[model samples]
Target: MAGPQETESTQITTEAPAKPATPEPKKKAARSRRAKAEATQPAVSKRSRQSPKAAEAPAPATRAPRKTYSEKERAHKLSQIEKTIVGGATIKNAVGQAGISEQTYYQWKKAAAPASESDDLKDLLALEEENKRLKKMLAEHLRKENAELKNKLGLA
Candidate 1:
């Protein structure tokens, strides 16, 4: 009877501590699960909230197509820009007034620079023409020589 009583008392003591420890671990697990659920819920809610706002927002404005300018128009714009500059305005303001970009203004200026040196360009053109004429004359002379050789050999 004593041995049985001791065994029962030990079992009761151990089970009492185990019951308390088990509840603590369960409580901690419940808290962690709640935290995970809370974290996931906010992210899902944020995505859902942003979707409607994105759909309701106006579409981004489309860019305009590029404009093409003729050579005469370009020349007129360049002159206008130059006159504005001569009147003490900056290049930016000058180009803007002429309805052209700074890059276009600079490009037109560079192209016009060569035209100012017409004498050099004219001389270059004349030299090229003379070279072509000489080449034609040389080709004709060679053909005549080839024909003379073929006639002497009686294979013309």
Candidate 2:
């Protein structure tokens, strides 16, 4: 039989493993209170309506439009024009060498010519007027389609 001291040691070794300590209840109560507070707060609306005057802010002033051209494009066109004038290159040859369509070259020439006295400038102005007319026609078509859609949806 074991001695008293041996028995005590044996009892300590054979004792069931200690259970994990339970967390304090106060932390859980605090988290639950925070969740309840958030739940009670009002939700924000997604759609907001603005006053008509505020919505209709004046558009920015139109700035003078500048032509966008690459250095290669400018050089090629200038070279072609030089060739045509000095080397007696045909209009077709000049356009081909410039890497642009014949019509485009003519249009550029017309636009660049003197506005006061040149017939080419008069032709260019006529083309510009025609372009305006075409744009107006396209805008009207789109407006009609928009009106039709609005009527169908009962939003007119």
Candidate 3:
């Protein structure tokens, strides 16, 4: 009696799992149809090319629409994305949370950074140049003062 009940419960659970599994076959069927369509396409195209009257119009390209973001918006999204990544979230999760696709995230990451990063680099370079100039001037002034003092003391 116990063995039959255990088997029955397993059978019920198996049925429940099977329901989800059923959808995969439908997906595979759809993919097979697509494959068949693609497989036949080249043959048809080749034949059409040989026949002057069978010119087929080109298929329209399918692409996701481009979204334009302002500099502030892009910076905000990038910061949020970076925070999520630093918090140990995967890139897929971070981008999903930011409501942007992986493609968009990668595109933004690859392209030039927002103006802030470049501006900081420029400022650092300018400060380095100014520091060099000031150091040279201070050294020259000290050398001149030292010469004058040595002449007064007859040391030079």
Clashes of each: 0, 0, 0
**Could you say which candidate leads in TM-score?**
3
> TM-scores, in order shown?
0.38, 0.27, 0.47
Write candidate 3's Cα lDDT for 1-156 as tens digits: 579889999989989976774455443444587788787665555766777565556544667678789867977898999999999999999999998999999888766464568889999999999999999999999999999999999999
Candidates in order have lDDT scores of 0.83, 0.71, 0.84
lDDT of 1 at 61: 72
Residue pairs with colliding backbones in model 2 are none
Clashing pairs in 1: none
**Weakest ten-residue segment in model 1 by summed lDDT:** 21-30
For candidate 1, report its TM-score.
Answer: 0.38
User: How many residue pairs of model 3 clash at the backbone?
Assistant: 0
Order the candidates by TM-score, highest first. 3, 1, 2
Per-residue lDDT of model 1, residues 1-156, tens digit only: 579889999999988876665444434444587788676663545675579776686655756689898878887888888889999999999998887789989998899778767868899999999999999999999999999999999997
